[model samples]
Target: MTASPSAARGLAARLADGPVICAEGYLFELERRGYLQAGAFVPEVVLEHPERVTALHEEFVHAGSDVVEAFTYYTHREKLRVIGAVDLLEPLNREALALASRVAADTGTLLAGNICNTNVYDPADPASADRARAMFTEQVGWAAEAGVDYVIGETFGFLGEALVALEVVREAGLPAVITMNLHEAPRTREGTELPEAMRRLADAGASVVGLNCGRGPATMLPLLAELVDAVPVPVAALPVPYRTDAAHPHFQALVDEAYPGLPSGRPFPTALDPFTCNRYEIADFARAATDAGAHYLGLCCGAAPHHVRAMAEALGRTPPASRYSEDMSRHVYFGSDPTLARLNLEYGRTL
Candidate 1:
């Protein structure tokens, strides 16, 4: 199941050929597996249960992810400090990167180290920016030592924080894939338009820039189209696999009318099962994103192996997992096989 060393290519080089899928949202996915908590969302699972992390990476690779991104989304120093496990910061990040590296090597997929929004970044506070910079520097340094193909800076809602990440990644001399998270408004939290913000990242040497998380295909696509026109570099679009419409542009804003009185009053993080997109919708998103000039495509939170497989197939790739793709022809009632009972097939209409 491993690709030869000769077949390995860098992220940008692979992007030149066609779409590159980087499966993200590890925090949410692992939380569902019960290894990690949802509230803190820290990836202590990287150290607590290394095997589970490795298994998830391999699953994503087999399902057709072109990149095995480290599960260090919220493993930064600030998040660790909040959970009173600041000492576990370096060890957790290194472990996550090591786990992802092994899977990427085995599957011949690109290896990526990750950095995400530091909840501390505030444009009005220069000290907060300093703390964010230090966090990015340390994480990017570890990723470089781990010899990742690139560093992915995602889910950033503030342009200032994203710029800090880009600078740190650049300082480490690694290709940077910087993406922002739009919360309801098309503009960043700092009041910058998405296209202009992406342009700034691209101009500042980001290899790829676009949007990730906080929106679904319906809401993310329009913003993606704008970025493609603004930035000359290949755009990245990884949306949450949810049915977010204009009324509910962000998953957090989605009102679960069925459960009018939920504790948190929101379906995000958990209890979003009712709003999840089916495999067909993900496939449609893949096709549309490709046509809209987004060479880097994937699902953010709520992504599963089947969704990844569907995306790869929609991009005209038959990944290893595609072998088990749905075969309606073999079904008992809707099957086209002649050997099936005609009576059962006829009675399927009533059922």
Candidate 2:
């Protein structure tokens, strides 16, 4: 059976002319606004202040984001169960879709249904896999009903979860993009090498497939190069803004995990110290990723509107009018400073 026009109008066509700029760092932005608690995360903000969510979406669009992603990360049933707010699963997802759609309508940005990690997709565990599939199925259905322009599965650490998300979106007859959160060793947390894993996601019918969120551009460049060589589809590159290497990658490396011990009661985004990329570094990565064949250029955790605006400008695309200029010199990191890079220390020669 043929799919409807809405379902068939995939991301491929929208991005055929050039890379589509997208960004979804709402959780980080909300935490900065003091809208989220330690354990509650983003969903709490969605329930209490949907207006804030809508406002951020608008902000991103104004900053040159072509897509406004629904804030569905951490709104899953299992995640809500951890905070004793399991009853809010449907409401949270529905509200996020509503707010994102509203912003898209107001700003003329595309609405993308965003799904992320499950923290329980173990390939070794069948029941866990089944549950994840069910979760993706339900969320994809909701996104389709809400009329998202496309659906994106991002920040996944395990290949199993990413694949399931891709499969579910494909089955739902929607345009889908799946991006894994891979760091270190050229492999996923599940130990699957990314080249093979990316191929699997593409072959499994992801309209676009690649990596995002585990590490910053410094580390993701090599992985994205490998992905461009492996996949036939358009690639996505949405690394976090902070510093990273394979050794200490993942934005959570800055955070103390709630698992092996007492809950820190620490807010969602700790260690957000500005040891991060300025707009120039982000733009450098965007250009390299584009040259390396990434067609979807964007930012992940720790990203702000300035970063998006820089990326849009770097691609030679006109950024949104809400911001006039990039002002790269404002950040020493983005500025032309040989001293900050410390060449003398590396080579032991001032000259």
Candidate 3:
């Protein structure tokens, strides 16, 4: 299942040029579109109306993402099995890839086949490991056959499972981008420190590795600095768009404790999500990420196309025409950066 030499060369040439905008947050976007359920997370939208999925890819491409990731986050076979739809995994994944491929090629973007935390990985159990291998192998087989530019394995919580994903993707002959879902502690739930995790993933053959899915940019900056210094390879980040200030660096903790409402573990709780951030927050985060040497920057859950536009502008790049184009007239309200007012000439300074 190795990639053809020509394909390898193409990928290498793209990387050599520079970093790319790899926007994600598909599950959130689809849910917002009313195509997928929150608790179920079936991704049946791909099978029922693939045009919806294609339209999503088109949005990211328009938002200036150089990589149109296939929206197959929860499309894994076992996730489908939960709703008595195990039979749909192959078609779901393949069709998702097909739509992404068309969008990528048509828009001059790279197709990134997507995989995620299967939640079946167990470090101490051999049978659990076997199930994980089966899951990754099958998905990689499909992605490589579809000629994806590379595969992004993200939101991974367990180090053992993350390693298995990297191994499977590399064995299949496609480059791998692996990102773990990190909390304030900068360790996997399984207790592996992020620096150690980065070194291990790099040694284990992950082409690009970093953090994603949890915590906002304000909280991620410290962890990202350590990551960029630890790994020689490029780093990618797609953090959620929540306000995870220093007091509450963990989004789960905020939701679990019910920041303003009663604590509920319900997925996609609206009250729990009332602490949403604005475009300026992502712009500030992008500046810190670029300074920290993170090349692959993006948003994860709760992200919309406007956030992507802010990211592009913050990075000094012209975003491709998007439905919600970046507004030039939006003046900065306030930020950590020093500002001066020139209205009354009492204390005049440049904006």
After superposing all C-alphas onto the true structure, candidate 2 shows an RMSD in angstroms of 7.1
**What lDDT tens digits, residue by residue, belong to model 3 across residues 209-291?**
99888788778877887888898888887788888878777676564444434534432344435677788888898888988
Off by over 4 Å in 2: 1-10, 254-268, 321-323, 326-351
Tens-digit lDDT track of model 2 for 1-351: 122233344467668878998886777767877887644564688879988888888878887888888999888877888888888889889988888877777766778898888877888888998999888888888999898878999988888888888888888888788998865566888888888999998888888898888678888887777788899999999988877756666655544344334244422256555457898898899899999999998898778888888888888877664357844434345544454555434443332
What lDDT is obtained when candidate 1 is compared to the true structure? Answer: 0.89
Q: In candidate 3, which residue ranges exceed 4 Å CA deviation?
A: 1-12, 256-269, 322-351
- Whichever of 1 and 2 has more TM-score, that candidate is 1
Predictions: Cα RMSD each: 2.1, 7.1, 5.4
lDDT of 3: 0.79
- Arrange candidates by TM-score, highest first: which order? 1, 3, 2
TM-scores of the candidates in the order shown: 0.97, 0.85, 0.87
Candidate 3 has which clashing residue pairs, if any? Answer: none
Top candidate (TM-score): 1
- Sort all candidates by lDDT, best to worst: 1, 3, 2
